[model samples]
Target: MTDKQRTDRGTREYRMGELAERAGITVRTLRFYRERGLIPPPRREGRIAWYDDHHLARLRTIAALLERGHTLSGIADLASAFDSGRDVGEVLGLGEPSEETPVRLTPEALSDYFEGETTAENLSAALDLGYLATDGDELVHISRRLLDVSSALVKEGVPLSAVLAAGREVRGHAEALASLFVELLRPHAAEGDLQRLRPLAKSVVDAELSLALDRRLRGS
Candidate 1:
């Protein structure tokens, strides 16, 4: 079998030189990145080191981030954030989101979504808020709606930092609102009535928020 076809734990493994060739970097550059901890250490068997597809994906992500004007130091920080972020199963817990669609994004795709705003701080904040989770080499955003709204706000000239701050505030209010609705309904609700009546609570909040925005605009 070819060196490329070698299997490590049921996944394809490549020698350091072959990995560098596949990732379009020289062996020297790969070593530099490894030295800086940009990529995880490879699996070792005897005297030979075996890099996997995950390393290749990380290298490509690094290249993409560099193309988007990210400095190596900044990329290293971002990589740290990404690696340490929560996983999807942990974020979702016992139940998946009932109505919101989760979005799986490659690192480059996430950068595209926020342009130059995809900083380590913002990524860390999103992970802290449970809005983002890691799934292998990709990121899983908890809600497609929230993702779209955030991207739109950034495109509309709202700084991502401000957007994330606003989200934090909104999260508190949302949680309170949810608790209020649950308390109000729990006494009278049947076994599954709370789940069934969730949309009604959502509608009320949506309408109230729209009116609140209108009033704020008029007052301004």
Candidate 2:
């Protein structure tokens, strides 16, 4: 805070016991955390040390995060993520977080395309696969890439069922690919290996996907 703001706010601070009560934690836990260097001690006035709401709020956040299975060190890493501006989701293993775009579709075209044959389950699965979306009671192909590929496959006499089967198989392959990397790294990767692993894994995955796409297109 600005010095003026701090002064105007009277440096509103709380003692260890008071802050821990406010944060729904035990004073002992807070003291232990301080001792472990997971949390820094408050500033002192003679013999008394005091904490502010910033510290209380941060502690509460840390507690919530720990309940979510994050280590104290992991919580510190997350707190630092704001300043670093790196892939927070990558660090959290929550995938690349992104905004969802609502795709539009029209019902009449969807009815014509599906011949009024699409089940609700099929429609939901199609949406999950980026194949279709609700466009006013019509399932609409939201992705031109998927539409084009499926069109070519249909022309080549491959049924939609076979295409869906292949999709499930590919998903299994992705799981296997992930397992392979985990096994490879489990024995020797030190802490903070994700930075090195991320680019390596991305490159390998992208290359594999590219070659797989080409192989599929060429009927291999």
Candidate 3:
């Protein structure tokens, strides 16, 4: 807002500079995003334009999708699709469902994360395991936890191939555990209640795993 442009009674307004600062982007970049239709048109008061919290939220969402390996064109398409009230499942076209946050990385960045272990064969294996999806020049890891754990294991001298094989085994056990918990909940709980109580299964698993580790360390 210009110094002359005061708040219009009910709605809060911010100047371009203020909006740019809030979004952590330069004015030039903000303008570029606007031109690309990545952000909505701001309300204009004569020559000055004013932005609001909605603009800030859109900017943050864009940043998150970018971090998750969406190209600008793809983000634009998603934004348009979401704005049009399309189903999220349709917009993504994901092969497998996942609740974990995805991590996006370039080929070089992926190599760095895995300590130079992102070989062609390992990449193929990851794709086959549904642990990775390609988005233009980026690779998106289906689960951030899996990506971090795999990278850490590689750093600890585990071969990438072995880590991937372990991941496959863990996937089978994880699915069985999930099925067991769902079966336990199906007859006794409402869907909403089951969703709310989902963390209980994780707590049980964590406790049991800890005890199992203790027993193994004690050779019992």
Per-prediction TM-score, please? Answer: 0.95, 0.34, 0.56
The residue ranges of model 1 lying beyond 4 angstroms of the native Cα positions read 5-9
Candidate 1: tens digits of C-alpha lDDT, residues 40-80:
89988798888899999999999999999999998988999
Best candidate according to lDDT = 1
Error of 3 at 67 (Å): 24
- Summing lDDT over every window of 10 consecutive residues in candidate 2, give the lowest-scoring window: 82-91
Give the per-residue lDDT digits (tens) of candidate 3, residues 1-220. 1522445565456788878888898999889889988888998868878887667777776776566555777656544533433222332465544367877765446656775455556766777676776653356777788899888889899999999999999889999999999999989998879878889999999999999999999996
When sorted by TM-score, best at the front, the candidate numbers are 1, 3, 2
Q: Record all residue pairs in model 1 with backbone atoms less than 3 Å apart, i.e. clashing.
A: none
Poorest lDDT segment (10 consecutive residues) of candidate 3: 82-91
Positional deviation of residue 118's Cα in model 1 after best superposition, in angstroms: 0.6
Ranked by lDDT from best down, the candidates are: 1, 3, 2
Please give the distance, in angstroms, between residue 99's alpha carbon in candidate 1 and its true position after superposition: 0.3
Model 2 accuracy (lDDT, Cα) = 0.55
